[model samples]
Target: MQTRNRVAMSRRAFAGSLGALVLCAPAVARAQSSGVVRRNTSGFKLHNWQDHFDELGKGIIISDTNSRVMQQWMPGGEMFIYPTSVPMTDELTRRGYTEITFKDPAPDWTPTPSMRERDPSLPAYMPPGPDNPLGARAMHLSWQYYRIHGTHDTRKIGRRSSSGCIGLYNEHIIEVYDRTPVGTQVKLI
Candidate 1:
């Protein structure tokens, strides 16, 4: 009788565990299918271009600092998303509307005044190269000292590591630079 009771308890525990797993299966499947799991560990959600743009004049770029993701919408309504490195802190972040003033295929780097003040050892100027912080390309924004640019340190992508700019992987920035044009509207949020 004792052995039979032990077996019944074990079976009940197994059934309960199995039931719990079955209940959780749909949520896991849904998250994976919806791209909330595989794309980013930061819980980044895809954005709709219409939410941030009045019209797709030229094109639009929206960088979400919270999610560390940049979403681009082309004139014809196609969209692309890329992971990004955002400002390291809220104080370093600049929000609101801006436009791409120009593009540099081989962008140079110059630490901003505040950046220099914070880190006096930083070089005053760096010419474009593999060693340059601005990796392969850069899209200058209307705001001075701000850019949506590539970084040599690929680890910075999908993290809060930039001083004030949005940083992308070198390959990703090259693609973005090719797709985006001067005067493309951008919003940082």
Candidate 2:
């Protein structure tokens, strides 16, 4: 009987301590872990894009570089530019996209090695570098081969000069690299 009483007391104490810790935790930690952001850099800093977030639903990704924006529509063949995002990392995991042939409609699922073979000049497929075609990070949409990647070409920051790929700046690419994870949704306009 005494053992049973002690066990009950211990359980109550544990519960009370857990409740206290929970209450003391920061609100940011409580935010959804579903988001992914750039890793190598310091904390991602972002500002609102003035556009209403309510109208957007497919998915939202902030630029990982400095202040810049590049939005593109897959089927519609249009890219909208605005200073909507800054170099802010998100804890966002996006849809899986392995680099394969750069087809408009991504080809069958394959590992991201074929891309390196296809563009042998684009440096070896390293994780985070100026030449890595995957850019600092890639936000994979439901689409197969397609991805929103950063570019070594600082000049292409606001250009739609990819074979159906969305190009981001280099530093911004790193910012995206830090935050994005494996299975996040991408709603490119």
Off by over 4 Å in 2: 1-59, 62-130
Query: Tens digit of lDDT per residue, candidate 2, span 1-189?
Result: 355434445888999988888776643342433332222222424433224233223334433233334332122222222222221122222222222222121112232454556566654424444455445555554555556666556666543344444566655545444444444333333
The residue pairs in collision within model 1 are none
TM-score of each: 0.78, 0.36
Runs in model 1 deviating more than 4 A are 1-42
TM-score, candidate number 1: 0.78
Candidate 1's error at 29, in angstroms?
Answer: 16
Tens-digit lDDT string for candidate 1 (51-124): 88779999999999998888887898766677899999999999999999989988888899999999999999
Per-prediction count of colliding residue pairs? 0, 20
